[model samples]
Target: MAFLLFLLCLILVIFTVTTMGVPNIPSLDPVNRFLKGQTDVSKIVSSDFQEFFYDQTLDHFNYRPESYTTFQQRYYINYKWWGGASNNAPIFAYLGAESPIDDALWSIGFLPENAPRFNALLVYMEHRFYGQSNPVGSMEAPNMVDAMEKSLENPDTRGYFNSAQALADYAELLLYLKNQLQAHNSPIIVIGGSYGGMLASWFRLKYPHIALGALASSAPILYFENLTPPDGYYSVVTQDFKEASQNCYTTIKQSWDVIDQLATTPSGLAYLSQKFQTCSPLSNADELKNYLKSVYSNAAQYDAPPNYPTARICQGIDGASDATDILDRIFAGVVAYMPGMSCYVTSPEVVSPSESVSQTSIGWEWQTCSELLIPLGITSEDSMFQSLPYDANVFIDNCVRSFGVGPRPHWVTTYYGGQDIKLILSKFGSNIIFSNGLRDPYSIGGVLENISENIVAIKTTEGSHCLDILSSGEADPEWLVKQRKDEANIIDRWFAEYYRNFRLL
Candidate 1:
């Protein structure tokens, strides 16, 4: 009876592989491809492709192949088998951020090893213009800026760089892979972080038919405006500066009131002006005032410690002359210095109008708040920058409308805000999960406030930035172990229950 069963399983495997159009496994090395001593039953397959089609825009009338075709698209598919010898496996497609592919692979350690077979698909679609993906004719800043501006103004041209189009491209790639691998019946899981996280949410909403589950980490869901600095961001910066001063420097903390009071004095104004002039972007007197004027309008939000790293703002020293002070560092010389090694000034002659607006409207807000107001103790004009709050209207207008390509779709999925998730999950019957860090400065308990039945928010004591950091040894070891356990358990149970029962409605 046992021998008969073995023979039947072998026949089923053959049939499954043939149906999928997958290459057949040779009899000589059949054992190598199947689970043996290990309790887990899974296999890994690698493939290389010359190129894949991507939608450049929302208008069906326009299309263009991604310009840089030098790098071959390489991916890995992991398969988890059932108890039988047949080749039935689920799939999990991971879309990582700007980091290298190797780092993304390492992050997958959070997945369960004992679970059923699954596929892990990796795509090397370098972010639009970065790395090998530069599509503009000239790499110069002026030319690049002009292209971006043109894209924003013309829908036909805007399709390639927008997030909506990127999501569509991924959907197309999945269909092609399904046909190529003959795995149309398999379930797929989509996951990502940062920008990749944004893509993951967009994919779930745009192509719900293809995905069983999605995990979006540190994703900024709303439009670009919401992500930009607002008045609240300036308030947060002030609070952070005040707190840091109190904690790190006794004199500053005790005399914080004096700093504010001094702003009224002419000598104080002169002193501050001198300090700002030294750090201005241009040495010219006229240019310095213009930059400072713009700074008042474009301040960033310093909401929490995680999003606003102390290194980015507060200096670890005392005294007005300390180079660590925000004023000294940002305006000590003719050119203004901002965090992240970016500058406030640009050559107007070569700047693209669209690129100029994006930088001025969104990027400047964050930079100004962080670099100017907090240090100077000045009031912010935009209120949203103070805290990471959930304003659906603001999110819709600033995040979705500003950064999205083409028109808004009917369905939407977001994982960043508990309030947003609650509302979305309740209305759409969607799955929402919050994978948070205890130490994360942003979105603290923000994921749990209005959770719906379909939403689940999980907290990791040591989790940071989409649970990317581990708790053990390196940065936080204990937190790492908890994160690993949580991830493994989540994936294992999800596969055992939800994935095993998934079917097209």
Candidate 2:
């Protein structure tokens, strides 16, 4: 799917940590592209950008026999607005998250909408180990067996999937392209949202020469290594509803106990199954609880736009008749959030438009187990969900069980410098715009303040998830309009600085 005319934000950004430190939460189903306001992407043929594949090194940090191997990495390049190598136009590259990057060419609206003004060239790099970039094989490959999930299951092929390798892939590809196109003077600005946003920020931090700056929208760089509160994520989820209405918040907070009591007897379970429209008979409260958790948290995570005074979820609850039971009203909220569903299947749980192409991949699960150890959980004490804070022992056990390896929980901060963020960035980091919507749960771990004159944070209260980087709709709030405009201005300034510094060189 392609062609771009400032389309609506096509993908939501999700980096959620699953329960009990386990991974395998499914991503937003491809069948539900409409979940993110995309209506008919099937017919949107490629026009502005063309897909290309590069032979990328399998392992960048090793010299083993496997290191010599290469995989074809997919990328999209849109040159319609490029000023060409002679003019040294900025190249905007969106670092792929844990996703099939096929959709991202038109999925994100930021680059296309703003490219014409700067005469910028837009490039979207698919992350290694995901989608068609899979080192071992791809879904498109004939005899797809022993490929993708099957390939990752093989320890020999799986070890190469890591942040370092993926970032190196981006750097090498961009460097090669620059040389090939003779764009030695053009500055490369990396862009990403959510986990890809983390990669964007880390890319700038690690390879300043390669990436001039980064637009890290909703990047939770400090979520690891105890940089933020353990309960910060779910607390924000709770606050979103509490701000909506006290009754709605209380009903959600009390939902667990009600679900527990109802799950005890077969009669209760039958009633529960019928009420939530569960496809199967209720066996335990776990699935139902998880369903509710996903519903509320996702609603809060993607909670944005036009649903003023209260979100649609809250409206469902608050507008319900006083005679309605709490559970019925809760179901009303679920219906509002996910309309037109025949029934709710709690096993895999329902992934919303809010749960984007991040997470849920075997590669990402392995990353979480190995290095991207995002310690996320909720507690009924403060949050609306049950107590489930990060348990090191449990997380380690899960990691060991799944990947036959344990997580380097502190490696991210130790490698990226999160312990003393403001001080570290002030002294060394520059030209990185860390943008967030306070409504986003990930924003709790984001840089919300100016770290330095050049390394800055741009945020808005009304925004949610990757709102600032998405398409600017006519219904876009003044804050969102200003955010995109402001980001463009800052990017313009960064380009100027890069050109000035290059001239000095």
Candidate 3:
């Protein structure tokens, strides 16, 4: 009894020391001060060198407007010289996808790192409810993953994930960084891909003053309202298959109709239905049918090529070993955004037929459509949608829409209206560069082709999905010099012109 009492006393003392001794301050100022004079900025100059270090604790300026509840957030500072810094080389702030910024897998050098001319700053900010950023109680209980699933299950909660809120958070971070680093004069260039691309565009639109220029590659500018399922998404899939067939001409042309026929067959329908049922939360056929219909109607890609490889899977037959199987195989190979968290299962409860089928169909159709077809296009879309064989529409929708307000006017109806890019360029004007690949399935050269006087739509015969290096690989050195080299050069020139010569409206 005495020993037990003594142990209890010791445990209490440890808890008190941990909880009270250190204020759980999540910020960067303290760490910044510690490194103020330790690392020589002079020797650290240049972009070619990329290094990583841990800033144990960085201050994150947490704030709350009257609109929402107060929450604490953390921001970690990661700096790497782009190359020996020039007299006034700009600073490129690279924001990664849903993954943490510190993960080396998502490095900026998707291309070769040559003479670096900018300072790449990676800000590791936790996506709401992800990593250490969960505002509510423990992530273990109603944890980040579970919370996301719950949000997806509830339609009302899904609306919260908009681009506007995300931009606001980024703006807060930028303002904090400017004051903290004392970089008032430094030109800021913001770059991101996929969801990160959406953030970059929003950042440019909402906080133009903070960024000198912006690069949003493979970004999904249209994600709200008009987004539909199956058919809408299949249109892109069909186009991708056609393109891939053309590329591998001898292998797969004129086969899509046959595959389509197979898909509707008893075995084909049963296979897909089973896959959907197994992967989703549907209990009845009607719900499954509605889900399939919705998928066919709204969630398809429009800008991909007619013959990409991934899209070709849709052209296979649907028997026990037909097109559906091909789709399964292809989907298996595609890289998904969320692996740890199931993108398909949004709720903990088993999906009901009404809720399960409708939502599952929409989510699956959109995602399957994207994953099955988008890669076939020369340039990939900023975002790819794939139906997880699970009922995760609730979670997926929340992450996509709620993470931010999404692009203004939205990309879905805009593309069909032929007014999407035009509307955005009209507002932002000359500061934007719409770059694309000629063979790209989505937007195919259409995005840049529609460029108005102010915005520059750059198309490279080789540049697909912002992958200048891969696209330029096949070109002659001279042709590349004439075509691809000028793309970046033009971007640099445009920046100089804008900052040095032009005035904003």
**Index of the highest-lDDT prediction:** 2
Backbone clash total, candidate 1: 51
| Residue-wise C-alpha lDDT for candidate 3, range 1-505, written one tens digit per residue | 3222111111000000011111110110000111112222232223433443222112122333423553444445445543222333455655433433332122333222311433344444544433334343254344444444554455433433333444566566666666666665556666664445546655776678887666655443432333322122223433443443433222323223333555666676455544543345433333333322222211122112222223323333211133344444322322121122232221212222112222222222222222211111112231122222222343234324533322232333343232455765676554544555443333332345535554555565532333432212222345434544654565576557655753442
- Runs with alpha carbons beyond 4 Å of true place in candidate 1: 1-90, 96-119, 123-155, 159-161, 222-315, 318-424, 437-446, 459-464, 467-473, 502-505
How much lDDT does candidate 1 score?
0.37
10 residues in a row with least lDDT, candidate 1: 9-18
| Model 2, runs deviating above 4 Å | 1-46, 139-146, 308-310, 349-361
The TM-scores, one per candidate, come to: 0.52, 0.90, 0.52
Residue 453, candidate 2: alpha-carbon lDDT = 87
C-alpha lDDT of candidate 3 relative to the true structure: 0.36
Candidate 2 vs 3: which has more lDDT: 2
In order of listing, the candidates' clash counts read: 51, 0, 80
Off by over 4 Å in 3: 1-77, 82-89, 96-115, 119-132, 137-143, 150-160, 220-233, 246-428, 438-441, 444-446, 450-454, 460-487, 498-505
Instruction: Give candidate 2's total backbone clashes.
Output: 0
lDDT of 2 by residue, 1-505 (tens): 1112222343433334343323222222111132444333343435878889999999898898868999999998999999999998889999987777866665577899999999998899998877678877654444322355666577888778778889999999999999988998889999998888889999999999899999998888888756877678788888888888888888778778888888887698888889889867766676677767766666666666755313777878777748357888888887776567667634433344333323244455677788888777665486777777667778788779877879888888887779888987889889999998888777898999999989889999987777776655667778889999999899999988878987898
